[model samples]
Target: MRRRRSSGTRREGRGAPASRRQGRRRGGTDRALCGAGTRGDTPWPVDYRRSATAFLLAAALAGGAARGEGVRDPVADAVSTVSPERLAAHVARLAGFGTRHALSAGSGEGRGIDAAEAWVAARFAEIPGVEVERRRVRAFRLSGGARRVAAGWPVSSPAARFLFGLAGMGFGYREPAMSNVIARLPGREPERLILLSAHLDSRPGKRFDWRTDAPGANDDGSGVAGLLEAARALAPLPRRASVWFVAFNGEELGLLGSRQLAREIERAGLRVEAMLNLDTIGGTTTARDLPADPALPPPGTLLRVFSEGRPQHRWLDPSPRRRLAAGPSEADSPSRQLARYVRAAARRYVPDLQVELIARADRIRRGGDHFPFLRRGVAAVRFTEQREDYAHEHQDPHVENGRRYGDLPEFVDPEYMAKVTRIAVATAALLARAPRAPEEVRIDTSHLGETTTVRWRPSADPEIASYRLLARRTASPDWEIERDAGTAGEVTVALPRDDWWFAVQAVAKDGTPSLPSLAWPSDR
Candidate 1:
């Protein structure tokens, strides 16, 4: 989704203040490297619990962080292969289609929505070990007389044409058939999925004008291009979890395609570990009318990641406002955790681009394809360009008052697109290779003590070498400290439970860390 101006206050730069110093720990024993029961009993009861069978299995795997000072990282190598030229070419090709409007006509000739869908499917099919599918979306009616245009109503008069165009801008028109293009790269654990998505549809200033040329190059062509490039880079690598490269349709029409996919995921009982949606990721310039924020980093040097501040379904709570007022978990939602993960990954891999965290579901009053997955309780986040040129988005290609308008390919920065692509590649690759997050993570809040007890069920993945207990101040936006809890399923930290938020992540023997699972308060 593209917005004319940013509404919320932006939190600039990467993660918590203390996260800059890597491999550092405070107030915790490094029992993760040592065998269980090696440490003596402490003042507070500490249960260094571990399953004997799981520990024995982990010991047989390769040890240490995946990428060390001298070691070559396959993940990093794949990330380095992201090409600016290839990404730009994709944007150009998609733009050449004239219009990719969700309800646009024509197919088999590489034009309109069907052609875009076919092109995306064919590209994924070319990559070895990748399976492609076009999942059909049910036909739905468009409101505000948009069905008139869909029904081919005669508009002989200029007044009638104007009325029809106005109707197009209302909501959306009837789409008899639309499909989301999905390309799956199966891994050792096919059920555990990581998704990368972008919308494949575009619209002109006259939202209902299907015949007009709305290239949509930077708005989302760049995103689809990035999805393809990430797939190409990660396809040849060995992954622990599966990755799905999806090009969603009807995003401009209220996220219809994503909503369908989310329903399918729930119906099939598929677990989406993480979902990254790229939208308008190629623009490097601010909108013509809106001045750039002086406090923000230069356009091409930064990117924004938007995630929900609280659970998407929090409205389901009977007393949501009261519950939120009493809780300190506003910044600790699953989607927020995923956003932090992306920022951390960018810091480690995409040094050239600074990822700014927008602690909101999306731009004010605007939505994207990620919202549907987020509503389904998936850890989803969006990646968009630091600044969007509104004149280009939803505008037709024309010169008006000496200004060039429309989302044209020439306005997209290839270098910037490459950097954004790298962030996705690095994050997805690392996550795909890491062990699944520890399950049933909980913090014991029964006793009134200064120290906190964190526990979780050991990950069944044989690659898990240890677990890291992460904690941050209640007021902090990101994790501030990490303690190596080893293979032990539980740890006692010398910190006040009421003053901090805690999470646990399983670390692979090769040093890859899985997504952190927040510790829920429990009386047990």
Candidate 2:
């Protein structure tokens, strides 16, 4: 999620220098993370539910999980919070690393990218029950050009197909070399996994230039800081799904690290429930060119969700006003669902800043490591700021129009970074400490034109406090709170209509819920 030079005071200097820092769960998450009755309208794309095609009809028609009545709003408790100041300090430290470009010695011990990788590995080791590994891959070199195509996603139906072709520019360098910084927090159910990630690589070329520091302060520095902040905040809790915190490498060269890891996971039969990718997330005050949806708080908020797949709700002002859309290809990915839950949680806890769920990634033609997960059929989504600052990205250090510009730390707002860290912290703590997601969610369509009855089994976490049923119109972006019945084993309800799709989540008393369970139907 790097930006190119635009006159916009954008997240300008990336692939530059700087420091980095900072900072979630379910019913256990529902109780601890979100307040009751505060769920808002989701900005759904035109065909968001298509991804659930077979899964949808089955869940809705079945006498279980997907077909439920009365939206349940589970109660949540405050898990933990990380200080913005502490998170900001981490971002600053990352800036000091000079260039963390892909193929620049990020692993195998010391100096350059390798030194930074060591630091990341060391930090991960500090977390209890954590295991670390190094993943390798072949990648290409960075684009040797200015910041024009710095920041940028998809299709299916007529709408989806068109956008998909447009965003599918096949960027990323050809096979060169890359590595991924991987870690694991193994939980009881290995089948359900939630991942937290950030790229350890930057854009600018291998050679480091002093003038154009490319400190990457705001670019990925904010992302790394946020991940660290999250780890710090959630370290004390027990989790339902095994959590993975990865500082991905080779993203600057086109998702090399993620691609490498996804294939390995798939090969190893590692079942990943969902993935949350942290890209650029430092800009707040800087105005961004987002979809302009009213449901979203301002861009300055600690969060912004990039939902691909489905048309991500209606677009902002104007006729032919931007109508959001995404394809099951890579755009409407598993991460989209994950992002929605995160937004729902933010609405209840961190109400101070805004967190918009922008329909697409970058402006129109870019993507991040999350795409790899999507390709592998593993749920995944990307997180980043809503603005673009080109002057500082992938460019030589110089000045124009009497404005001294470079990817320097001065351009980034540290306070803004702190907020981003807090959000990451909250999400990780909740996810890590909460119970595993429910399985076999089914909708009760058998009682033709009758009440909705949904049901499912509890996760391995055993201490699940309640189960949540989320029902939304096929076109809505956000999920409405359906039913939050405590886990007394009564998993059935009545829905208003069969037109909408339903999903289930298991929450612990703290607020973290299992990876969401789409209402899966049984055979006729």
Candidate 3:
């Protein structure tokens, strides 16, 4: 079903005091991980009364959880292999190619970069029934003189066309021969699509030194591996949305391959249901000289979920004032639906997973392949490990402190990437195969002058028990459900809307929630 929620939120940054750190204590007076004191023999965060409320909510969310006294994790066979490992191998192989500069292929007949492209194309063909498509794109090989226009992208938007027209001025024979090789999977429902992609190109140089072998295994090999692993797992499960796995080249050269794909989609009037651009999923933060975020005194504390778009901050800002403006939103796009689904699914599968949504475009200065799709109003998000060891990215392959440098396989961890992939696979499969997007989502504004009434239809899944309604303002990124002591989907939030984009979703008997309703009607 089509799921589009509204986005509204407060944007002013606050001088949040340093968060107090505390260890979780059982039945004690110590504070929980949230760092607040608890009465002796009571739960860390709440006393007996509040604890009972939490337990009831848990039982409501999952009958199994209630009965078993724990969350149920789906049984997944060991995903023994992760994408970053494979990426390291591929990068190592490319390192053997000497140098894959843009224009260097023109000099050597050994088919330097073409050989690399063919190798990637061959891997995709290995996937059963997956077709490999090679697109020969022509752009000016910008060099010293003879600055004349050759063949350019056909029927591109003015902004895109201008970008492309000017982009070539920075290329030439010094660059390696470049093109894009793409592969796709037809999902159960074609209306929605999930894309998994990685850049296949690396920087140019003579010797395959630290300056040459991006070995991009960790940088993007992890991404490709994620895409492939997701496909491998989901092929057996019927999905309502189509999934596309791509190995894009020219990412180092300013996201060239992604640009072409975005323009092509726009030209064809394509519907990109959602994009999970898997870039640099490997390599945890262990670089000896790692520059730290001064604001963050201690590093490597949280697993980050870099989310953007209109509804990016929906959970944090759910109020009537921001109803039309925010909450669990990708804002009137398929991506919003995907985000809501993912957020809900994550809560379902990983109860204690710590995910922080960065309100604006992925981090301060970094960007991912999702950018192109987003520019065209397609829903998109980037999945990267929370902390990055910047030393490994885009650097020429080299060694320091007797430690092998470059995006090597040893640096990438499979288990971490597997967790990331599993959530994605589950979310994609559910969205693609669910009966349809939920029906008739309306925030009950009838009592907006006082109480909050947010509701939606439940999924027909037979196992569904009740529905959960989470509220937040447009200004915050946290979904603070006032837990008065009840089930996950107790219904009808009672929080007063001060400056929020109030939204809600129906929960099925199985404990799954429908995508959030658009913002509630404001009192104006």
Model 1's lDDT to the true fold?
0.74
Each prediction's TM-score versus the true structure: 0.81, 0.67, 0.64
Question: Highest lDDT: which candidate?
Answer: 1
lDDT per residue for candidate 2 within 134-209, as digits (tens), equals 6655433322331122211101145543343344354322233345777877776666677888888665523332
Ordered from best to worst TM-score, the candidate numbers read: 1, 2, 3
Per-residue lDDT of 83-168 in model 3, one digit per residue for the tens? 44454455455545544443334434443557666776777777775657877544434343312232212323455545644655
Name the regions of candidate 2 deviating beyond 4 angstroms.
1-81, 106-111, 126-130, 138-178, 205-213, 284-299, 310-333, 361-363, 455-461, 473-476, 484-494, 509-511, 520-523
TM-score of 1: 0.81
**Residue lDDT tens for model 1, 12-86:** 122222231122233244444222232332222223222211222232223423334354567778889999999
Q: What are the lDDT figures for the candidates, one per model?
A: 0.74, 0.54, 0.50
Clashing pairs in 1: 32-486, 65-510, 65-511, 66-510
Q: How many residue pairs clash in each candidate?
A: 4, 129, 54
Model 2, C-alpha of 102: deviation from truth (Å):
1.6
